[model samples]
Target: MSGERVAVVGVGQTEHRAVRTDVSMVGLIREAAKRALADADMTWTDIDAVVIGKAPDMFEGVVMPELFLADALGAAGKPMLRVHTAGSVGGSTAIVAAGLVQSGVHERVLTVAFEKQSESDAMWALTVPTPFQAPLVAGAGGYFAPIIRAYMQRADAPDDIGMMVAVKDRLNAIRNPYAHLKLPDIDMKTVEESPMLWEPLRYLETCPSSDGACAMVLASERVADAAAKPPAWVQGTAWRSEPTLFARRDQVNPQAGRDCAADVYQQAGITNPRADFDCAEVYVPFSWYEPMWLENLGFAEPGDGWKLTQSGATAFDGDIPWNPSGGVLSSNPIGASGMLRFAEAANQVRGAAGEHQVEGARRALGHAYGGGSQFFAMWVVGADKP
Candidate 1:
């Protein structure tokens, strides 16, 4: 590998909500793309390629919708690609776009991801009948409840830890104007008292099924050098996959996630994530995964991550604050969730995150994982050019 450098010149996202019926899928994407182009001081004509990603077609009842969205996205003649990898599609899409630049294929690329769950029920979409598969799980909450309980058992993490995460992220979301679920009055007591959707998962703990889209404009080193302001240089990026439903799979702390983080850290020369990365945006649809992933992502040793969370190490004012943009816990459009994480990290570096911006965020980590803990994607972005 010649180690060609890449950087994010533009980033944009739609305000996540329960339903964005006012605009079609194409409109949602265009809105974000236009914002990104404006930020890059460019336009649709300047984009050299386009890449779109989303979760399964079942969620929107539109199989490979990107095929029909070409004209609207202004990619009629430009190179285009679509990617599907469950919930991590967004982050994975960004990685693919960055690869185009790093591989010397394209100087500019537009990557976008979206999900309009309002068109269909995600619970029903995910529970589609499969031969020999049990029909007990209703949706993601059901599928993940037992796993969360196991974490609480194995790690002996206090129940309040999950509640605290929900409250903190919800509070953080208020500052994020684009967040989907904005609980202004949320607090520890409110989270503790919220109705239980699934055992070990409360209404406050589960991610909201939202309708939104996110987009990013990536450029090569030469293109980045011409940007108006400092670009978020793509220091390192990685993606990994493992078979789902494996007998040996540890849902609580998947090795694929650990390996994925290790790869990006190694490429970026990061030996201590807790100390090196100024801030992070991790995919935590459920609050408990905050601590669980803290351990899995090498930020803390197993059985010790909860201590950090309890100590407020992951809070907004802590040593290495995480999810300063509120994260997937605050706003999740399923398909776009992962990409938003990457975009947010890029936003922090670009000094464009508005109220949720981390102070002097020089180095940041954007991370996402999905599909029964089988897929992982992460990237390290820095203010300084790579």
Candidate 2:
């Protein structure tokens, strides 16, 4: 919805792992940035601006991180901005970087997002103490368990639906070299036998605390036209948010997510998301979130998402593949997870995804959500310019 066309000319990510003790926070970011610049066939000096994003400061024990990271990101003399919106920061950051080019403010912008969960007690930091409210004693899993239960009841879904997702994504991770959890032997029995963490969510179904970073180089159409590699054109982008504890808030299917998806689809001329896009990379830190997001993203009717998954509609070989790169369930770097989804979608359209590539993919969708499912960011990218 803009003045100039925007395109993603390069994307890169670090090898995700539970703990990256070898690299400092700055080093983690630089590793990804360097790779992105190389993918773009450019150096740090080619960037006109820089944008970075991360989770709350308490998670890293670092405040105003952008200031300290300015030189590391090649932003010391160039315009640099930091973005934060809970887990959606990565997707939001890329949208902002694209805006700089779309609005004619910059010809090329480099955007990066990262998290080093091993360096800080993320569970403790996420357990914010609110007045008059009981403490979140069990972290993210406990907070979202009730919502998953509600969806199960509302949909009358099979008990094995979550297990199926766990198996599929883990298998997908085996194909992704950079994914953290490469559970090649993962299966339905393995997932069923795993210890339950949040009543319905088993240990095998949850995302690991990872240390990694993801970076992308966005440029104007003029620059993309001359790039060495094929560019993924940005057809549309949108973001939306609402109060976390508002009255009558539908946690199972937040209104902000629905609205945000609609806006992005409208901008991309998507009348039927399920049939329009070749694939999707959605934010699914939990296994069950895949089906939940399928409904919210307009890929399935309400209460029918689980059935779609059960029918193998979302499998890597299926018609509408989701998370061909294994997704957050396999490699979650918190703040960087969102941008990872965006980058993977871009890679799919560019025919750059090696093993998990969708055959003949021409258009794709990338999505992310945060803040108790109240904040949502989505975009559509294509091989051909819009």
Candidate 3:
């Protein structure tokens, strides 16, 4: 069935860091929620529903933490839903909230995603053995290392492409006050010389385990029209998933990601993503994924994604800027990482992003993937109503 139009009225996020020891989990969420409520010029009483997401319970060592967080999130007497879709949970959570408004079910919805990595060892939590699969990899880095190596070989990408991305995103983080890493001196030599964690993936190239939260308030078109600030109109949203591992599954470029991008672009009437989108905020937990996702998202042709990076086409001043807010590499709180991308896209369209704002960005893309790159979530947001 066709759905009602939805818009993002407010967005907020915590100051991402290695450890947010000042606040408890409840306090952390409340901080973001309060900020979002204030941005929307509303209060808890205006929210009709709440949706929350995170990577995994094991990462925080707290099973069903949402139960205790209900009161803090203002969901005690309101409809509350929990979501867990690995790394893509944040993006998926926002999608669910948008659906509530689109389906004429909720006039206003508060959606949030967070992770307190200091509470538990994310490496250990991610490496937990599963039945029928040998526990050979140490963490996400180890598992995705081979895939990156394969991409380099298949695409004939230069060895320095990853280093370029690492430098670019970290430098961009300098303009983002809320990002975790602020490497003002980061450069090619620094990235190339850093210790190697996984083959071809250096310490600078990997994402940090961070503690942070992000929240957004979505509203129906009727409510959004009366909001205090400009609303980011939801042009299109799509999600796709596939088994983690199957015969001949192209880990370098997952089919699910391709299909998800295709669906969103089709819905948005985007014939050329590279030209149609002013900028993009994609989930790039690792440096290399920038180019890999560039291809998967149809921004570049196959085996040519790295060329765009090498040519500086993805930089802040480039034709199609990417990750102007520093991105996953700079402040990855796992579950919150994807929502940060979505939120950043909305910020751009609303002209709220301060130093990192793209000039005349009328439309933008937000993308996320999880679980061996099998789960995909994408959306297009614009300043004009759809």
Candidate 4:
């Protein structure tokens, strides 16, 4: 939708798990970067620039991580740019890297995002006191529970909707080799019986703490045309942000998310999101957010998002499959989760998603959100050029 066409020619991700004991932080990232380079059939020298991102320093107790990770990613001599936009950093990082090619500033760009939750207590880090703000006593779940309750009250959605999503995504994870959680016996009964962490959010419905990394190689149309594998053509990309707290702010369906989706959809020429995209990989850390985001992203009308999920429209074989890769619920490596969604969307369009591949997928949507649902990023990719 701009100066030059950008396409994702390569994608790679480390095996996600609760704790990646096999590799140190540096090793974890290198593993992903190496895989991405190999997938692209290119060496570090082939890359013109590097872009990387991760969650807050407190999560890893490492300040300015890019500085130490530069050599590990072969970004020492290249123009490496680090991005931070809370949990949306990964998606924002990819968008920025793509921008380098889209603006004709670079022919090839390598982007990576990662997180090692085991390095430090992510929950503790998140609950830390912030000036003029109520503490997140129960971490993310505590903060979002009220918002979710508000959605339930406003939509009058079935209590079983969240349970259905948990079962669906965990079952989907069974097909994803790299996903951290592989609960093959995950069913609604199992989900309902699980311990309730936050009201309406069972242990099964909440995302796990994970350590993982993801990487992608983005190139200009010329470079992508010469690639060995089919590329996922970038149709459009957009991001938006808003203040976390304000008078009567709509946390259930933030305006920033709506605006971001509208912009990307317009650029991608999507008149009806539900019918246009074959699949979607969205940021749904909690099962309830799936339905909430469905409305915010315009995939469903207000107060009707849960109806689609309840009708099985978001299942793996549904009319519009959402998070076929198991998504954040199964393997949430906070920083990497956003890029994982973006990468999975690309994989679907390239027909390289293996078992999770959406048949005949020509177009797909990738979405991510962060910071009380204030920051939003989304992109559309396709098998055909825009």
Clashing pairs in 2: none
| Candidate 2 segments exceeding 4 Å error | 132-134
Residues 1-386 of candidate 4 have per-residue lDDT tens digits of 77799999999999999999999999999888888889899988898999998988899999988899999888877899998898898899999999999889999999999999999999999999999897878689998998999999999998999999999999899899999999998889999999999998999999999999999999999999999999999999999999989997899999999999999999999999999999999999999999999999999999999999999999999999999999999999999899999999999999999999989999999999998899998999999998
Q: If the candidates were sorted by their lDDT against the true structure, best first, what order would they fall in?
A: 4, 3, 2, 1
- Candidate 2 lDDT, 133-233, residue by residue in tens: 76766688888889999999998899899999999889988889899999888889999999999979999989999999999999999899999999999
Question: Please, what are the lDDT tens digits per residue for candidate 1 over residues 1-386?
Answer: 23578999998889888999888887888888888888888888899999999999989899899999988888989999999988788889999999889988999999989998888888898888899876637887788889989999999888888888898788888899999888999988889899988988889988989999998999998999999967999988988999877788898888899889889999888999999998899999999889999999889999878888889888888988879888888899999999999999998888888898888889999998888778998999999866
Tens-place lDDT digits, model 3, residues 306-325? 99999999999999999999
Q: What is the Å distance of residue 174 in model 3 from its true position? A: 0.5
Looking at candidate 4, the ten consecutive residues that score lowest on lDDT are 134-143
In model 4, the runs with Cα more than 4 Å from the true position are none
Native-referenced Cα lDDT, model 4: 0.94
Least accurate 10 contiguous residues by lDDT in model 2: 130-139
TM-score of 3: 0.99
As a whole number from 0 to 100, the lDDT of residue 377 in candidate 4 is: 87
Best by lDDT: 4
lDDT of 3 at 113: 94
**Candidate 3 at residue 130, lDDT?**
91
Weakest 10 consecutive residues of candidate 1 by summed lDDT: 133-142
State model 2's lDDT: 0.92
What root-mean-square deviation over C-alphas does model 3 reach? 0.9
